[model samples]
Target: MMDAREGRRVAGQRAEGVAARYLQSRGVRILKRNVHSRGGELDLIGMDQEVLVFFEVRYRGSGSLTGGAESIGYHKQQRLLKAAAFYLHRHSLWNHPSRIDVVAIAPGITSQYRVQWIKDAIQASP
Candidate 1:
């Protein structure tokens, strides 16, 4: 991979770590990390309040104009949706209530790692 691509991968991993920590702090139980399926790859999977949670971790380096959330385009969303379905079926939970979440991380000075957790980010077909 090129330098930019490598950097992006590293940043995404950092974002996932931050997101997982943040979710854990909120009492969410992590079930899996980097789960891949027909839909796409889910960065993190957890349980929160009796609901299955699928998370997408996005990160933007310092000095970047757009924030992390903006990086998640429509294609990414569609993949995540399909991935969620795959996960559900693989786990044999067709009727369980589930949700998708987005965790945006903006790394900067002072402390770095600014996180934004968006709940119910995307809806999956039933």
Candidate 2:
């Protein structure tokens, strides 16, 4: 019997998996998933052709008040930015083009899930 937290975690993992598959179908080659750094955890890391992409997979159940992408507040965005920076520096890939993307998932009527892939969804402060 999974507790509420565990159940949520499992569901989140499933959502990520679904998002990964969806992205792959659209030509995103996933390199990693659930990557953790000192700043925060990155949901997915992949390459879209020549660019490196850091994907944030957000899943909102049918009953949730906030939508998937809408749930990410300013603080969360900052953490994601920092995590992406850490990843880039660690891999010495600063020269490569990179951007943060969001894969927002929600319950769908006609399909199992509604997925919206927003490109370059997060940007660092100038």
TM-score of each: 0.88, 0.98
Largest lDDT belongs to which candidate? 2
Best by TM-score: 2
- Show where candidate 2 strays beyond 4 Å: none
Which tens-of-lDDT digit does each residue in 1-126 have in candidate 2? Answer: 999999999999999999999999999999999999898999999999999999999999999999999999999999999999999999999999999999999999999999999999999989
How well is each residue in 77-97 modelled by candidate 1, as lDDT tens digits?
Answer: 889988988988998987999
Question: What local lDDT score does residue 50 receive in model 2, on the 0 to 100 scale?
Answer: 98
What are the lDDT figures for the candidates, one per model?
0.86, 0.96
- Candidate 1, which ten residues in sequence have the lowest lDDT sum? 106-115
